[model samples]
Target: MPLIPMKQTVTRIRTEGNEWDGTKTEIRTPMKCAINEGTKLVRSMSGSAGVQGTTSSEAVSSAQIYFDKLADIRLTDVLEYTNELGITRRYPPLTIEIKRLNGKPILTVVSV
Candidate 1:
């Protein structure tokens, strides 16, 4: 039997600059290492089953719950950063989806 692998979808947030004529253009820049690392970790472990008796559906459900909690934790961290730096910064919450494939669980985030 083949074990199904998990999938991850991530959004790229970039700053666009507008010229004098009001034309917008994308600026190519490297993403933060922390963000990239976090995304990779979330993708790799999202579909992991905790115990042997757990079913694929259960694994998917667990993954969804884990992602939700992670989102809340991220929000708290952002709030703390804003408070400490006295600067207003907005971070988008991750959108995640979990499903079963070939008797295994899969996790994915919807692209925005």
Candidate 2:
């Protein structure tokens, strides 16, 4: 039997905002659960009777599994208003960043 090595995993989420001026804003999220690198294995077996030479065969197999924990939101409402100058525009998309602290998400940065 052979012992397999374990691997570390990292997760990140980022949000960005765009202004009419063409400037970009960014937010970075914290690392959540470490990614899990599954496993791999190979096995083979063969049998023969009254054979002049031994026969052999080989086979390979592998397995991998992981869990994803992330928060998501969707916008369902829109409110618009026109100023005295008669300029009208729709709302911008919301941006969010998640961070981890003490093995949990503690900070949430939001921008529009």
Candidate 3:
């Protein structure tokens, strides 16, 4: 027997091409997803250095969200997270890394 898990409903927004007037179009779908977040320190290049080419070390500690769903998510899509507070958060587009578990998609979104 296959194990059945509970599901959560989330709004899926995607770019659906442009209109004849040269305007962007979007497609929204209501689906089930699981969301989680974590924090860690990341190191990235700041800017161009001098002729010496000596770069400074900087550590940024920030939290990132990991959203899991059975649908395909795009980099240009915005995730709407719903909470009990009746406040809907519109998440900006970020680099999405996807992994599959039991033939389901798990999207890991990070802040840029």
Candidate 4:
């Protein structure tokens, strides 16, 4: 059992195609799941190039979600987050990092 309860609703299984006006397909099914949302962190990356001294920086927030042991998900999967505060947000995970914690699968996602 996990120490934290997965009460947040996770909507997965996004479709990406449509032909109505310009596209060729559309997604109609969502894989609803209950996952425990935890932790928030800011990740930043900076780069500098050449003698010209050009620089660039990128930053984004990341979050972790705990799912049942052996839960199936892919890195390319798009997830919609609906929290207890009644805020719903949808974004495709930047990168997925999975670990086994307390016998549960801990999935971490970063927003880009």
True-vs-predicted CA distance for residue 40, candidate 1, Å: 26
lDDT of each: 0.29, 0.34, 0.56, 0.53
* Candidate number with greatest TM-score: 3
User: Per-residue lDDT tens digits of candidate 2, residues 11-45?
Assistant: 23334556776765544333222222222444444
Q: Please give, for residues 1-112, the per-residue lDDT of candidate 3 as tens digits.
A: 1123325456778877677767778788875544543335555454555444434555543324445443466767776767656767777646666556777754544442
- lDDT-wise, the better of 2 and 3 is 3
Model 3 weakest lDDT span, ten residues long: 1-10
Q: After superposition, how far is residue 95 of candidate 4 from its true place, in Å?
A: 3.2
Clashes of each: 0, 1, 0, 7
* TM-scores vs. true structure, each candidate: 0.18, 0.24, 0.51, 0.47
Error of 4 at 99 (Å): 2.8
Ranking by TM-score: 3, 4, 2, 1
After superposition on all C-alphas, the RMSD of every candidate to the true structure, in Å, is 17.8, 20.3, 6.5, 6.4
What are the per-residue Cα lDDT tens digits for candidate 4 across 1-112?
4444545556665455555667654343443344544445444454545344324444444455555444555666667776778877666666555566687665433332
